[model samples]
Target: MAGTTEPYDVITMGRTGVDIYPLQTGVSLADVETFGKFLGGSATNVAVAAARLGRRTAVISRTGRDPFGDYVHKALREFGVDDRWVTPVERYPTPVTFCEIFPPDDFPLYFYRRPKAPDLVIQPEELDLDAIRAARVFWITGTGLCEEPSRSATLAALEARAKSGTTVFDLDWRPLFWGGEGGASGAGGATGATAMATARPYYEAALAHTTVAVGNLDEAEVATGLRDPHACARALLDMGVELAVIKQGPRGVLAVHRDGRTAEVPPTPVEVVNGLGAGDAFGGALCHGLLAGRPLEDVMRHANAAGALVAGRLACSSAMPTADELEKFLASR
Candidate 1:
């Protein structure tokens, strides 16, 4: 556990679990014989990614009281992320995600979080208010707002932080987690607007306490009811964020600052292995660049490059580039 006197570089809240990925690419889960287990979850991966980049990071979440939960802790420690705040929930077994890797485009995820996920049971009273507020960067995700005590806890942390240092709201829109049209399958069953309508208000509430808002076009629309990159950024700014980052998959990222400065960087080319972890990589790098007070354009470019590096790899948390690796990758590009 880190001492209270020294603030961590990054503190991320929400979601922690194990990911069971098929080692064989392009094979269905039904036929896959071997698998690899790693620490998984959006917020958890973000913390690990930051830690990999030499940031002093911790994750505030919960896991089940099972072997899988033990792996979660071991993984966090190995990744250099403080696991002090990640407790165990006795009621639910740890969540596990199965992914079918298809290489370039399609990697379908199957979430086994039925009944309830331990992370979603986070209580507001369990939060360390001072730690959240004191961190250089506090990262929270949209999924944190999808359920009960966690939703209130997430908001409570955001409110306590009060935009201190750098508060990031990652619009991690997982419809399956929301009990919406997507259910458990990879296929889409409804329009984005339908899910957006249910989640926009909560997203807006979180944005009120965030300094930076990041998401793709689909998530942006879910947060602001806007699809246009410029309009979405404008809406996020109006909601109290100082910066808005719109990640347009193929087109790269668009970052808009309230000071009227804007940077639209093109995507770094890579032969993508699993794309799911790219966003988390981008997020960790974004926090790194922002804490260093880099210019908006440089930050976006650095984040883009970091994301590209992860996309070229298979694992999410383990593939996060170290500071040396990131610099080399950027230089080579």
Candidate 2:
């Protein structure tokens, strides 16, 4: 708690799970015989990425009080994130995700988080308002809004920022855990109409408090049901979002400000290896830009380049680049 200073760069709260990725690409999840494991979950991924970039970061969530919980704790420490707010709960097992990642194509995730994952136990009453109020940036995800107590807690985390004027960003996540009975599948795939309807209200509420919203093209359709990037951006602003980012693979990203300013970041060239954690990288780099007080154009470029670097690597947390590494990668362009 001693390190809870004014604007400690970044603070985040949401899902914390283990990711099991197939070691070999271009094969089915069932066909793959070997898998690689790493710390997973959108909010935690963003926290790790920001910390790797030398941002002072803190996390708020719960992990199962078990060995898996220990792994999550160790991972956070390894990344230099302040885990003081990360709680461990009893009885439930930690959630885990399985993905099939083929280069230049698809990454399908199957999540095992049901019955009472520890992250869902996070309650608004347990939140430390001071940390949320004083942070320079707060990152949230749609995954937290998919359920009950966590939903309330997610909204509460934004309340202090709402008053403090902290820059709050929304990361869109369409996990299999949502849209009951295998309804929502794939990122931005129209596979979950029922799930989309179920999630809209919560996402709209989330956007109401967000200063910026970031996600891929499909992620935008999944969150807002608007396919056109510009329309999606406009819809987000209408919901009170100050900035909206609609990511276009290969073509780059288009950012729209509520003030009518628009900028497009050119894509960073890279050999596609795995596209699993690129969005998390973008979220972290965007935090870096905002915390450093860079121009909007520069922010998108930093984020775009960060994402490209991650796409060329494997795993999630390990793929997050350090500041020097990212600068080096950018310098090459």
Candidate 3:
């Protein structure tokens, strides 16, 4: 706990691990000769991205009591993201994720979170309700909803937040994590009608407490059972969020506010590299924009630009642009 009494700019809960990415571009994992290790997990990356843009951020999750866990703490401190709340689970080892960098579009990831991930071991009792409620932005993810203790803990945080400030629900939607039969195809693969059915009730519960919702089209479908962007936005708004952001790959992003305001921004063009952490970058920028009280259109544009920068890079956390980099990229466009 870096002793700071002031409210945090961002507090994200869920997911943390080491990302092992192939350094060689456009190569299969089997043929990859070298790899780069970096701190990862959607929530962790978003926290790092926000920290990169000069926001005071912290993440609430758990890690194993091992070297990887130590690495997690070291990395968070290095990135200026608070790790006071990141505790350790004696049972599970820290999760490790590997990916094959297939450029222009395909990036296949293999998750090594067997028995259970320490992140999913985050129990409600361990949460600091005061910190969560006081943050300027509180972010949670769908991946946290796939399992127990974490699912309950996530909801507890949201409930404590009570729609205060910028409460965001990131519909992460990892099918494999949820045990979906379709693998990574059906909502990241936790699929089949049974998986979707199991997830919706929890999504509904989370949305009831969140003010902002963000996800790609596939994630939106998992949350609302709707594929059309407009409908997905409507369903999210109806579910109780004040804002709904739909990320459409290639085409761009659409943001709809309950106050009858809407912004549709096109994707910023960039040669894709890994394309894995773009959404996390966008999420961090979105939190920054919201905290700054920018117009919805400007927020969407800024987020799109941030994401494009990371999509063109190799690593996720390290690839997040600084405030200067984001401005330069936006000005160049």
Tens-place lDDT digits, model 1, residues 1-333: 234878999999988999898889999999999998888999999999888888999999999999999999999999999999999989898999999999898999888886788999899988889899899999999989877888899999999999999999999998656653213322332444455566778998999999999999989988887789999999999999999999998998999999999999999999988887899999999999998889999999999999999999888988999999999998998
Tens-digit per-residue lDDT, 155-179, candidate 2? 8878656835545555475645565
C-alpha TM-scores of all predictions: 0.96, 0.92, 0.96
Model 2 TM-score, all chains together: 0.92
Ten residues in sequence with the least summed lDDT for candidate 2: 180-189
User: What is the lDDT of every predicted structure here?
Assistant: 0.90, 0.81, 0.92
What lDDT score goes with residue 257 in model 3? 100
In angstroms, give how far residue 163 of model 2 lies from its true place.
5.3
When sorted by TM-score, best at the front, the candidate numbers are 3, 1, 2
Better of 1 and 2 by lDDT: 1
Candidate 1: Cα lDDT at 285: 93
lDDT of candidate 1 at residue 144, scale 0 to 100: 91
- Which residue pairs overlap in candidate 2's backbone? 188-218
